[model samples]
Target: MVPDGLALPDDLEGSRNCGLVALSVVARCSYAEAVRAYTDVFRSAYQRHPRKNWKGGTTWSLVVKAMASLGVQHSHTEVTSAVTLQRLAQFTRRDALYLVCTTGHAQVVKNGWVIDQRGAVPVEQHWGRRKRVTAFHAIKED
Candidate 1:
């Protein structure tokens, strides 16, 4: 459950397509379809590729390709500084928020939370203290 004093936006929780693979799956389906497709593909992808190395782990390129395969368009931005929740808030609302961390890990942000292959949690709890965000992709519907 979301923590107290954190008012999640209406659009946030319902549309959380966390994790690189999960985001890719969301891109494959229509917005309506994505609501039900959450994390389904992520589980399958991990089952297929359990390794976490560069070649085996989920990467931004892979996410891009997955989205492309479904005809989704997106724009990428490289973040030079530590990306805070405030910085992320500046982005225009889109279908999903794909973030690449300095550690080379990728996750998705929706509403005010971060959703990954493992599960969903508040952004501050998931990324507020750990890895620095290195880049972001604003996904657009085709």
Candidate 2:
């Protein structure tokens, strides 16, 4: 039997049926949502991946060029190299967590968030309840 909350049609055909179509649509929507949630993180890391920005228009090419650029006469090739695509990728991935944490929207915390019936401001618990102030009494000293 078809369960509630599902839009499966009873008259579904063979493998190429409406149920399958609905299932695919639901799956795609779910996948899209997951992708959207993670895209920012991916973008943050992808931008810095060394491979993404190597000279000669490619990281590998840049590495090769750098290796060859040094005159053969040099006794020892520069053990170090410029930022490669791999390095860039590593850099971005390392920073992605911090970037996302620092870049996202601000979350306001009230004693309690309040919304009016019309969804207007000053909703219940908007600002914590205002307390009354009482005066202190002091006895007169001789």
lDDT of predicted model 1: 0.51
Encode model 2's per-residue lDDT on 11-53: one tens digit a residue: 3334322212222222222323322323333344468674653
Clashes of 1: 1
lDDT of 2: 0.22
* Pairs in clash, predicted candidate 2: 48-88, 49-88, 49-89, 50-85, 50-88, 50-89, 51-85
Off by over 4 Å in 1: 1-20, 28-55, 84-96, 99-102, 127-129
Compose the digit string of candidate 1's lDDT tens values, residues 15-131: 333433355434543433433333344454567676732333445555555565555677888887666643574463633554444455666565566655445676667754366
Error of 2 at 105 (Å): 31
Q: Report the C-alpha displacement of residue 54, candidate 2, in angstroms.
A: 17
- Model 2 regions more than 4 Å off: 1-29, 50-142
